[model samples]
Target: MRGKKGNKEVLKRILLCIRPYTSLVVLSLGLAVITVGLTLYVPILTGNAVDYIAGKGSVDFGMLGKLIVLIIAAITVTAAAQWLMNHVNNMITYRIVQDLRVQAFHHLHRVPAAYVDSHPAGDLISRIITDVEQFSDGLLMGFTQLFTGVLTIAGTIVFMLTIHPLITLVVVVLSPLSFGIAGFISKNTFQMFKKQSETRGELTSLTDEMLGNLKVVEAFGYQEKAQERFEEINERLAGYSLRATFFSSLTNPATRIMYSIIYAGVTLAGCFTVIAGGLTVGRLTSFLSYTNQYTKPFNEITGVITEFQNSLASAARVFRFLDEEPETEDSPDAEELTEIQGKVELEDVAFSYRPDQRFMEHLNLSAQPGQRIAIVGPTGCGKTTLINLLMRFYDVTDGNIYVDGHEIRDITRKSLRSNFGMVLQETWLKNTTIRENIAYGKPDAADEEIIRAAKEAHAHNFIMKLPQQYDTVLGEDGGSLSQGQKQLLCIARVMLDLPPMLILDEATSSIDTMTEIRIQNAFGKMMNGRTSFIVAHRLSTIREADVILVMKDGKIIEKGTHKELLKQNGFYAELYQSQFAPS
Candidate 1:
């Protein structure tokens, strides 16, 4: 069973989204009332026409014409009212969907980097787009239709009873049975729809994964395997969709059957009353019309109820995302750093991606301002983990990290991160103009400043040679540029930011020897007067470091200048010889 508190809370949140449109809601309800009033006059008009035609009452042509005119006027008014109600409903839905999308996006931005890393991009995209759209279509339209159906049903039933209590009994008797069928079908359909949505999310995740790694899939000849996996998900989704349709489709037919039975019973009973000289033709005609009107709202009500159930299921998923807690940040009183010299120190910092294992423990290091420090280690030796901690991407579990003598946790993350620039091994570039990509780091930078930064990164000459020079558009992920050229553009972006501290994690690892030399030269200039942390697998890149730290198994096994480390002849010496020695 669903918790009562949870249902109430979710409904409260959904209602809050529409609170701003209460005036429109009021107008819609008012229109619905007018529509009901107009439709209720139809049965009375039919009764009057029957009496005049039967000649059992005095005939008045003028009065008959007026009654017919009133019937037509009522229909016209109902149509206009319905149109206005629909427009208001659409406006309210639009406003609510807009607010929901914005709020979901804002929450996503505030979530922790770890949460983002752990969740699939495709799944997140589906929740924001498809799930939210489902909620809008189902919850908004379903509820509006439901409200109108209820009002129509109530008004019709009350007027119906006023005509003849005996006929009203026939209609009311079948209602409970009709509702039971609708409720059962709705419950089954809701389950199937939920399953369908879940399958769709999985299919979306699979497609995104394949597309993101298309090159690898092609190179490894896994296209067939990927397709097979996707087909499995698609097949499951189709099954669930079909099941939902099968169940929901029963609602209208079952209600129609009950409506037919009630109509037949009422017609038979009216004939008996007329033949017994107890009821006139006009009264019987009016009762039949009322019976039809009464059943119509039940049909509509049943359909809306089914739709509401399905929508509620979708809405539950959407609200779950909205309720997610984002990553926490520093308190309002957190310290702010205006300027940083980039003196960094890490003492006994321990961390683990999982609770049962430790990736790093008791790690100790320090770097002076403007000094170039290099970290070298084997694969999975916590080299990148150290950089992550220093950048405060993952807070240390055990010890303190200080930059310029201030505890990292005490400072606002934005203020702390503003002082550092990073260039990763895989350079990422947006599908945009070269000029815009370079200026991305500092959006306010002038064209001349961008070009100057490009020159400083040794990327200006090559950029000028492109088809449109700086204005040339890059393909997705900078596909238009060679690997080395893409790396050059990344360096230029970093140069534009010109942070006080820098982390170069295998920045030159992918470039050719010739490009590597140019990058190294540009890097030396950029490093001047800035504290630098260099993680290099290629030992030659870090020969000029003011200090070198050798790490193994999350511990800093050795630390010293290059000459001092060579004399120690430990892990660093072994790693250097292993790479440079003859094959």
Candidate 2:
């Protein structure tokens, strides 16, 4: 029952995707029907010509010539309609594919960060590119042929039944066996194809990971292990591909064999009918032609079913991704944070990445306006998670985070986030000019303002040394730049933004001590009037913090000024000592 429902859902989504092109689809189908009708009628006309020649005792040249001309005209019409159908079908199929790709790409942005974090980028990309393209190709073939196949079968059957009911009965009986065989193969193949599609995604993910981190893999001398890992996935993908192909391949031959058997039976029955004078020789010829035409469609349909099964499998994956729940949107009545005071407070904050594991419970903290609150914690102690909650990347499970006394949830995410400038440890830059990278937080920033921010962040020196200076376009996430340079660019962005609040997560961890000192001095000047939360690894950076919260296991074990904590010789003291004590 679940399987049926899933299949129906996949089909429903596919239909919905194609719905916008209904007019073209209808026109394509109409052309197919016209083609099939003309083609079917031509064969009947040819049969009549044969009957005319046979009855006249000799070839009636004039009448035969006229019949031949009529047949030619019908064939010409059929060919024209078939050509038009193919053209229309291709247009409709590719257009639907374009729309689906756009929709899938658009949907990804709306999906929750958790979904993206858990799913591989390569897998999502495969669904959007490979699976969607394959589905479109399959759809094209199915749409192009399915209508003609059905119409030809129905028209051929009707014509055959009219010619000889007994032979048609033989055909009708044997036809079910063909359909039954195709159905059984189709059912088995669907799962295999679906598995193959999934395996392909896995393989793509692994390959993408390996290639994207090839330098790291090579540096670590893990190429052999990576190769083995890729081979394992590749071998499994190949196995699934072979199985899917083998099963789907069974349909055409199996159906064709069944069709041949039916053809033989129909021929025998027709021969008997002709001998009995119930059917003429010309009619037998026509019946044989009709039988092949009828069974030919079944053959085509079996092939279509195989393609359709693959397409359905791919479509299911695409739909599954599309159906992923997006991030919770702000409420309609949510207020915009137009002017923020930089004061933040977390009240009884209880949260966890997973509901089953309660990471933080009854957590409370407060930051006064213009206060530099440094958060010091052991790794995975909900430090970044706290930042995430503060930024509303993930909402609190059972708490309220207030910015200037307004609950973070009550404010629009865009408006709330815009109030804070963040420079994370891991920098991200687009493939664009260094000036644009710095101005990302303020897209309309002036050149002088951008240069001032870069100079303050100590990035202007490197920017001046680059090929095009600030106008240089970076490659793939600014991979062309050094890590410290990237960090400087990010810091420059925050400097340009100069939001009411700041979140720095090891923002200068990549830079040299000299550069870090300069950046810290700049930060000191900037933090004078803005609230700041710094997640520091190097204890030396937060000596002047108004409050230092030492976190462990989601609890703030100690909270005081850095000097106060050191004086007390508690968790913060030990952490600071451990970092700066020795090597």
Candidate 3:
């Protein structure tokens, strides 16, 4: 049932996963062996009873009583062994699952930002939860039963042969056919399971996409369209599931039929041998019992194999995700920036989401320490790209960016990012209290400090009005809060961090004019003596900027103060007049 790749290597990898619990594995195996031995003794005892009864002798009550005690002992021992095996198997599975979950989560953290951005959240979650769970099932039941079944089958056959070799020979002859059928079914079942896993991933991805964009679907009146897409994925998943189940279900019945035919044939042959004066009734009875014993393990082995194949399919998906390259990190020799004055420069920076379409090229800009630089541009004019580059969300395809006179790539990413605080266009808040959200950027901030930051961002009044005040729990993504409230909370989070450089990317876009004025005043105070970059489409917001850069096609076409840019009558002047001038 194992793949073409060496079973030794595959087993080695599996063993490595369980190496820490070697003692438990050994104990479970010992229990299984004991249980098998006890089970095998039952039929032999039954044969002995038949021989005693056939003899024209006394009842031999003492011997019968002893056999009875042995039977009870065997049952008790087998039950205890089964319990131990089950316990050990469960413990190992739980530990392996825990380890796997941790590894999956850690791998997710290590994966490249670009990879994560492209991967669907629901599919990834399915791999971690569903796929990993499937693997655990195989590890527990599949692995344990496989090992125990092999030993039981082998031991049962060896003892049966020792007692009656001819009967054992006949039974062994029929076994290959049974194995052939099971093997054929198992191979096909594994293929179906792989397809099933892929379909499930697609289904999860589609559902996640729809749920995440629920607002867009309703606003665009595309509810029926979304439902249709979801239904299509669901139907495909159902089809794959049915195919997998069909193949898997066939294995058991097929094995059972093959074993039943072999049993009938063996019984007829044993009866003929007895009639020919070659075997006694006791021997015939015991041989038939041993034949049945062998089939039980064979049946179990087939079931385990099917389960194992299914788990392998899930394991492949999970392993594929783990194998993906993680985010690149700076070299160990990378320079660390302890103190940053926040002087920033972009020299001939060129970037593109795709190679054919360059967003920014030869984009040169510089900002002095404590300077307030505002970037204004029409929609889709690379305003956000500038902030993204500054944050190193992506690397420049050409030229370099410098901070505090040091090349950015040369500096450690963590240290580079630590020097700046950001408030973005779309605010993201966790499902936590307002106070906790404000304190997130600086986890060690005192309650008073958190309250002060919230007040500065104009979030404190609304927060205090809630019944639980700062302790009230927010819903998922802070759905309970208004857009302005969420943005203010984000700003408050940024303020609490108090980094040397601040980048506000449309920070006031969601708030009303009155709230915007209040937030603007607060932002100006927060920006004092800190190097600041503002990316705004609203011309009125940058009226007081120390310098303005009007970006078009990722290049700065106009650079000047508000009065100078207005006088120049260039792109900046046109945008300003269009947005703020009287209608």
Candidate 4:
């Protein structure tokens, strides 16, 4: 179920990410305490040394020497602790961010195909990459400055109280004003930062769209329009960024002004105490130093509030994605198909993308162990949807699909999908060597096996012409390869696996007539005893199918052998005529 996540929940999740690094967290915290404690004690040592130095030579030289050395030692230790603390903070922040990115990536795999299909890839990439990096920045500040600042403030208060309660009371009363200012500004900027984050995601998505389709944009002379669109998004992001910065920036000066009042009040009250003999001059000096130490952290806190707000916004985006409801998992008792014979059946199947609109209904189909079933239909006629159902990418709304007598829902999705080899119209080749692309479906396949698959797909000859033959590295999505070549690589990938069943959805549309003929011959041998479902817009590709199903409006209206359907002169015959008849 989808749910709105609050800041507390998002923070809680971040803490959970940190749970694995408990030792590091504890060490950083300990270092912060040591650093702040020594930092606060330094003023005391300085004040005592001030008391001992009555005049130049009249000063107690021996006592001053010990205080000077002790002060130096404390300062050195504080510096060292602070450094170690920062190093630890970085470790925790980056490690947590690393875990978060890994988890987000793996979560995408479990999410429904519908989610990936419907969402913009660029937006998701931004959340996983850009947003996560922003969160890391915020997290590092939170771990180091936030923690140390709070500790320093607390330690200063303790020292002030031990020395004189009345002055400490004044400082404590003025402290809430600082918190109030920081809180107000942070709250205002939080929404702006969130808006800024979303705008950035939109901008990234637009840029990715333009880059991925650079050829189309250039061909259509749409550079000016694309730039205009980019400028609009970039402008909106700038506005949001400026507004958030302006508001959060106020926290610093405003808090500093309030702190100035606290310093003034402490100085006036502390002077009166020294005059009345209630406080010593040296103690007064130490108390004043404590006052500055006490207020310094508030300044530091407010200064970082802007960065923290941005971090929180980015974190919220990441958490929202991580919180998405993953696809329904298989039941515990889901059976595995160890030995499949390629028989498939759909009984009274009903499906739809939306509940209010039914697309396919009461659909029934059966394929014997070895048969070629060609599906012919116009666009939006459920041709691909049927294949999706068979692959278990989407479950049927009613009835059940069975493979080898086992209900598909009852069988594990992995095993069911593994038994089917699919090649789609859109070719997707990883940026790797030709051998790896061909062996993608079966990664452990031998080089000889990969060569055989490439040969079957009529891709081996062209691959050999490359610099490294099978070892030739391809560029993004098969690089500068022609559409036909790319499609052949995709075909080779599936051929390498050679699963028990096959689904080819316009898989050969990009290949030339000569290559298509050879591939068809290869498929003829491959489909000898395997159940095959071929979805083709070109009527001639499936002329020899044992059965042809003509679909309209998501329902099968005609089914027969190609010759039998031609004899019926029904919808299937009409489609065949449209392709074969003279213009």
Candidate 5:
């Protein structure tokens, strides 16, 4: 069985989300009550008409006409009320969906990088899109019928009790049988539905990961392995879905079958009462009408219970995502970085991706304004991790990183990051016009400035060759452009912004050798007076750095200018020779 407290929490949150539309909810439920009330009253009027027409052996055509008119009026009122209720229900459903989607989307931005790194993007997307929609649909459809079903049941039972209390007691006792069956089936189905939802998210994540790395999988001849992984996840999803649906499907038929028996018993008992003159024929007929009305809602409610259970499962998933702790907020007295100098220093820095493993400890470094700092290290030696700390993407665990004499964490993240420009090995370009992609860092940049930035990044010649020049709309992630071209656009973005500090991580790795040379010349001009940190796999790229820091296992093993490092003949010299003197 599901946790009662957790379900209540989910329900409470859902209600809060809908609380803004209180007037709509009241109007919708009111219309449903009115519709059900008119329906129940119709049977009472029909019973009275029957008694009047059967009295004293004379047919009263006038009374019959009047009864017919009243019944028609009730029918019209019921229809109008139902239509209005349905309209309101639909409106509330879509509006709540919109609000929930917006809230989830906004929450994602506030979430920390650690949470994002741990969770798959597709799983997050599933919660926001598919799960929210399922929960919303179930809430709207079930609630629309639920109000009418409940009021109809209560009103019909009360009317039947007034007509014949003895038979109404029978309904009260048998009603539990339907509810019991629904409860039992729902308990079994809840976990199955929950599992199915989880598996669906896994499947979505798998598909996204596979498609995003299709080229790598093909190049490494891992297509069969990828397909096998997909099939495994897909099969698990199918199994859970089948079991959940099978159990929930049992509720309606089982409840209806039990209610059929109750209906038969009520009919037989009423006939005997009428024969013994204990109840009028008209009263028995009215009671029978009310009995059908009362018991039919049990089946409706059983179906609604299944819908609600499924919705609750999906809602639990969505709410769990929204409840994640976001990134730590800036300090109350945080200062904004108004004018940054190029000097940066890391004092007694310590960091680790996990608590048990300290990747870097007691690290200290400093860069003078307008210095070219090149960091060379073996893979997994905390090179990028250092940059992450400086930019405040991840905070230093045990020490301080300062920019212009102020600790990095004391500054607002937006302002601190605004002073640094980054071009990583993996280029990120949006699906938009070429000009827009280049001008992303400065959305309001002038056309001439954008072109000049592109020219400086050595991208203008090829961009001009495109069908629409800068106006060409690129496909998703700029798939229409080559890797080198995409990198150029990314570089142009930073060049246009002209941040005081630059971080280049294999910025020219994807370009051909000739293009690399051209772009490096452009980068040399761009880096003239900026504090730059260059991380490159190709040792030749940083040959002219003001200082080269050779790292091994997160510790600095050597640091000096190129000539000084070479004369020392240390780790940096070995790394440089290994690249230049290849077999």
Candidate 6:
């Protein structure tokens, strides 16, 4: 029952995607009907032609010529209709695929960051690309064959009934056996197909992980182990694929056997009717043709059950991704945040990634306009988590964060985030020109403005050295550039637009000491009148900050200037002195 419900849900979403292309589907259906009707009619014309040749020289040449012409005309029309039907099906199928991929990708962004962080990137990519492609193939096959198959079956049954009721009943009586075979097999095969799809996703994920981090894998000399891991999953995937294919393949031959039986029985019955002089030789020939046409649908549909099962599995994966819980919507009364005071405050904040593991609690801080606050903490000390809360990437559970006296959640997230510029230790650059990467935060920035920001971030020297200068294109997140170069570009991006507030989380960690000094000077100018939060591991770099926050175990254990913290001779002093201590 649950499996049936899942299938229904997946089908419902697929139909919903098809809603915009309803016109094309209807047109395709009409063409399919016409194609089948005309195709079925040709058999009758053939039967008539056979009657014309019943006895040598008794043949009616004139009648035979007309029947032959009608047969040729019917065949031509059917072929045209079939072509038109397939064209319409392709249009509908691909259009539906386009819409689904767009929706799933767009929704991916709206989902909480945690969801993406938890899932493997390759699995997600598989759903978007591979799985979606599989779904499209299934849909295309269904449109191309399923409709015509059903129409052929119906048309043959109707035409056959008009000729002889008793013979038709014999054919109809055995159809239930074919359907039962298909239904029973299809029901059991769905689970295998679903497993096969999932295993394929895992294989993709592993391959992606290894290839993406080829450098690391080779460096660690884990190739043999990696290959073993690959083979282990590969073997499991093979088992699933084989099972799915084996079961689905059975449906075709199984139905064919039943069809063969029906065909034989009908032939004998029609031969007997002809012997009794109740049926003409031409009619028997047409009846036999209809028998093939009738069984063809059952064979085709049962055959498609293989693709249909796989498609359903792939479709289920995609729809599940589309249905992921999006990030919570802001309050209805949320308003655009404006004006640039640069003041921020966190009051009684409490949060955690997992409910049982409280990352932070009762955390509080205040930054006055133009004050430079340095956050110093050991690893896993909520330093980045604090930054995340300030930026509203993850909201506080028990407290309110305020920007210029307005609760952060009360303001639009876009407006709130736009007010702050951030540069993190980890750099990100798309496969695009350096100028575009820099101007990402400010796409309309003039060339002169972009170059100026690049100069400030100490990326101008490297940009000028590149073959294309600012127009130099990056590859795979700026892989061609050194870590420091990428970091510089990221810094230049934030420098391009110095918002009212700033976040520098180890922004200088990748650069050399000499360049760090120069870039720090640039950052000082950028942060001069803007409230800034700097989460740093190097204690010396933040000596000039107006206030230094010392964090430990998810709490701010101490807060003061460097000179004051040293005088106290506490955790902050211990950490600060150790960095500069002798080996």
Off by over 4 Å in 4: 1-5, 55-57, 271-281
Deviation from native of the Cα of residue 311 in model 2, angstroms = 2.1
Report the lDDT tens digits of candidate 1 across residue range 1-583.
1444655676777789879989988888898888877887777897877778786556878878988998898899889988888888888887888888888889888777677788888888878888878878876665467667778678777876776777678878877888888878877887787788778878898999999889899999999999999999999999999998888888899989998999999999889988997667887888887778778877887777666655566667677777777766797788987778889988788998888988889988888999999999999898898888887788888999999999889889888888889998988999999999999878889999999999988899998899999999998999758888898899899999889999999998878998788888989989999999999999999989999999999899999988788889988988888988899
- lDDT of all predictions, in order shown? 0.84, 0.88, 0.85, 0.90, 0.89, 0.91
Q: Residue 504: error of model 2 in Å?
A: 1.2
Please report how far candidate 1 places residue 430 from its true position, in Å.
2.9
Cα deviation at 380, candidate 2, in Å, is 1.2
Count of steric clashes across candidates, in order: 0, 0, 0, 0, 0, 0
Error of 1 at 108 (Å): 1.2
Runs of candidate 3 with Cα error greater than 4 angstroms are 1-16, 276-280, 355-357
Better of 3 and 5 by lDDT: 5
Tens digit of lDDT per residue, candidate 5, span 1-583? 2487888888899899889999999999899888999999999888878877767778788888899899999999999999989999999989988988898999998898878989998899899998988898788867687889999988988888888889899888888988889999988888888888888889888888888888999999999999998999999999999999899999888988998999999999999998898887778778888888988888888777788887888889998988998888899899999777789998989988799999898788899989999998899888888888888878888989999998988899998999999999999998899999999989999999999999999999999999999999999888768999999999999999899999998899999999899888988998999999998889888989998888888888889988999899888888888888869
- Which residue segments of model 5 deviate by more than 4 Å? 52-56, 278-282
Backbone clashes in model 2, listed as residue pairs: none
Clashes of 6: 0
Candidate 4 per-residue C-alpha lDDT over 1-583 given as tens digits, one digit per residue, 9 for 90 to 100:
1123477777687788889999999999999999999998999998888888744458898999999999999999999999999999999999999999999999999898888888888999999999999999888888888889999888998999999999899999989998988988988898999999999999999998998999999999999999999999999999999999899889888998998999999999999998998988889999999999889988888867778878888988998899898988999999988778988999999998898999999899999988999999999999999999999888898989999999998999999999998889988989999888888878899988998888888899999899999998999888889999999888888888788899989988998899989999988988889999999998888999988889999999999898898899888888778888999
Better of 2 and 4 by TM-score: 4
Report how far residue 69 has shifted in candidate 2, in Å.
3.8
Clashing pairs in 3: none
Query: What RMSD value applies to candidate 1?
Result: 2.4
Q: After superposition, how far is residue 15 of candidate 1 from its true place, in Å?
A: 2.6
Candidate 5 CA-lDDT value:
0.89
Model 5 C-alpha RMSD vs. true structure (Å) is: 1.9
